[model samples]
Target: MKRRIAILGATGSVGRSTLDLVERSPARFEVVALTARGNVEGLADAAMRTGAKLAVIADEARYDELRDRLEGSGCRAAAGAEGLVEAASGDADWVMAAIVGCAGLVPTMAAIEAGKTVALANKEALVTAGALMMDAAARSGATLLPVDSEHNAIFQCLAGSRREDVSRLVLTASGGPFLGSSLEQMSEATPDQAVAHPRWSMGAKISVDSATLMNKGLELIEAHHLFALPSERIDVVVHPQSVVHSLVEFVDGSMLAQLGSADMRIPIAYTLAWPERMATPSQRLSLTEIGRLDFEAPDLERFPALRLAREALERGEGAAIVLNGANEIAVQAFLEGRIGFCDISRTVERALGEIDASRPRSVEEVVALDGETRDRTSALIAESRP
Candidate 1:
């Protein structure tokens, strides 16, 4: 039987890459639903292309437009948070929880409660509410698979190994567009330059995170949660080529690594076809042409985001939530030309300083904390500006 799949963020880059795999062999999969936050046109296009049965737009105002666009196409349309939750609860064998940021949490939890195998691309969900998500998965028997390249690589390497035999997880980084540049050079960096990642193509926010090494930082927190490893066991290595996704060091003095082209589809397909690998049309890695891979330690003095992320993960009083929430706000500010690239980490650090001592007990509390941090961080940026 063909697997029933619902893509939670069908209009973004990750969603598009997933669509490529599903579209290639429609006989192997069915797209039950597709959703976008506000990209009605893109959502409609994706729905029609996939012949999805349901489409939802998180922006309620765009519902009428989405509904009209999908008219005569045999796909139903919905709007708002309720719509998002309903779509997630619908009949689907698997849900690609690809909604970019913290906004993806509730619906992703809904998918988990619905007992769907969740392909998690939204790192914030785990970073902010990993314990909650893991608990939900354990309760509901939902399989939560990691879709981020680093986490996915670690997953592959540790497939049949005992947790005790595992030594550490080493995540590779592309080092972003400012790899060779000094901190002085980064202070005056522009958004376009930051988003121009050294290896992988990505959106402005994530690309900016790469520039500050904060993307790696966020991934570290995600790894800590997803792999059930502590902050000390997971490490980040700067690999500019982007060929080696991640490595798993064993207690026996050896390491296992997963290497491939920097294509999102590889990991997406890996998760989608878990336990049974599916062939992907991604560009094959050419080690001959891309001769050598270099490794180096991340510069903590230059990229304080990584250090801040470690501190947040350690503090645990909604610090990860604050770190992610603040970074999101600051990244948006920088992208809008409201702040400097360096100020992104500054904003996150300030939010980290103002954190509530109480840790969030539930996903609801996590969401609330994320919202509160975003609001606070936004104000902090504004106050610092003039």
Candidate 2:
């Protein structure tokens, strides 16, 4: 039997990798739906090539262009938030939620509500509404598979072990491009330099988060939700080699780790063939060729975003939501040259302090609070500008 698949952010790095694997093993999978934010060309091409039943464009203004592009492709076209929800909740058995930022929250929730097996690449969904999303998964009997390399590694390590025997999870970070740079150098870092990740190729927003070590922090919150753990039980270490994806320690002093080449397809393939392993075109790991593996503690003073994320995780869901919302805006500002690289964490810190930390009981409330935080953070940025 073939597994039905849907990709929410088909134009992204992870999404493209998934499509590559699916394209290679055509007999094992079928792409039922494909969506992109505004890349009509890529979306249309993927939809047509995969023979997907539906192609959705999240940007309503590009609906006509998308529709025209898919006119003779035998794939139906839809646009905007409603279309994204439709794509997520369709007949696909495996849905890849890879849309960046808070915009992915609703559709991701929709997939969970529909009881679909979700490959979650969108960290914001778990970061902002961990409790709510987990509760929905529990109620609907939906399986939430972590696609981030760190969380996926932890998931694999705990596969045959008892959850009670686990002591802590160690998530490894590449430390981005500024791993060794001083605080002064980081503050003066350019957007290009920040996005120039030494290990992996990624989109701009995620690259910035990696540069500031906030990506690791967001994964910490995500691990808490996925693994039923607390902030204190999780640890972050700087592993410049990117070989050891993550580690899990047991109460008996036994530590298990998942090591692999720096490839998104490895994790994507794991989720795609759950309870079964699939072959991917990822590079094979050679410890001999790449001799020494180094590790160190993350310098909080140099990258305060990780510290801020840890603080937010300890404070609860509301603080996490504010942290993610504020960071998203700040990262965008830095990318557009409206703010400095170091100012990204500074902006998130200020928003966390100023925003009401009241916990949202529902998804609607979460969206409202996220919007409010983004607005306040934007104004705060504007006010600070000369």
Candidate 3:
């Protein structure tokens, strides 16, 4: 039987790539539902291409437009965030949790609580409420599959191996566009320049995080939850080539790595076809043409986001949620030309200082802290600007 799938964030980068894979293998997977924030054109196109049974727009105001577009397409239309969450958890065997930012938490959690197998592309869900999400998964028996290339790579390398035999998991980074720039140079770097990632194409917010190495940091918190590993056991190395997605080291002094060309679909396909591998349309790696692969230690002094993220993961609970929330606001401010590039980390640090620290016992508590951090971060950005 074909797997029924619901893809949240159906118009975003990962979602588009996932649609490509599903379109290719129509017999193996059926697109039961698709959700997007406000990209009606993209949603309409995706629904038509995938023949989704239900299509949802997260913004209620766009309901009429989305419905009008999907009219007579035989796809049901719904509106608002609740609609997205309901569509996500409603009777689909697999849900692709690809919605970006903290906005994804609710829908992704809904799928988990419903005991649906979730292919998680949203790092914020794990970063913000790792304990809450993992506990929910444990209670509901949902299979949480990692869709990020790095985490997915680690998952593949750890196959058939006991968790106790693992020593450490090393996540590889492409180092972004400002890989070797000096602190002085980066402080004045423009958003356009920062978003020009060296190896992979991604959305603006994520690209900026990649430049600051904060994306790697957020991934660290995600890795901890996904693998049941501690922060101390996860490390990041800047590999500019992007050939090796990630590495897993065993207690026996052996390291295993998963290498692939830079493409989100490879991991997306892996997650979609879990416990089974399928051919993807991603580019294959060729060592002969690529020549040499380079690796370097991530400089914490220049990229303080990495240090802050590590500390957040160590602190647990409110820390990661706040860190992610603050980073989102700061990055937006920087992108809007309202703050300096380096000030993003400074704002996050300040927000961290101002927010009260506590162990978030529930998702509600985590969301509350996240909102608090973002508010404080926005105030910091405004005050820091001339």
TM-score of each: 0.98, 0.99, 0.98
Instruction: Please name the candidate that would achieve the greatest lDDT relative to the true structure.
Output: 2
Q: lDDT of each model, Cα atoms only?
A: 0.90, 0.96, 0.91
Clash pairs (backbone) in predicted model 2: none
Better of 1 and 2 by TM-score: 2
Query: Tens digit of lDDT per residue, candidate 3, span 1-386?
Result: 99998999999988888898999999899999999999999999999888899999999999999999999999989999779888888968999999989999989999999999999999988899888999999999999999999999999999999999999999998888888899999999999999998888887888899999999999999999999999889999999999999999999999999999899999999988999999987888889999998999998999999999999889876888889999999999999999889999998898888887688888788888888888888888788778
Residue-level lDDT tens digits of model 2 in 1-386: 99999999999998999999999999999999999999999999999999999999999999999999989888999999999999999989999999999999999999999999999999998999989999999999999999999999999999999999999999999999999898889889999999999999998999999999999999999999999999999999999999999999999999999999999999999999998999998999988998999999999998899999999999999999999999999999999999999999999999999998788999999999999999999999999999
* Candidate 3: 10-residue stretch with minimal lDDT: 377-386
Q: What shift in Å separates residue 20 of candidate 2 from its native position after superposition?
A: 0.5
Compose the digit string of candidate 1's lDDT tens values, residues 303-325: 99999999988988388889999
Model 1, global lDDT:
0.90
Which model scores highest in TM-score?
2
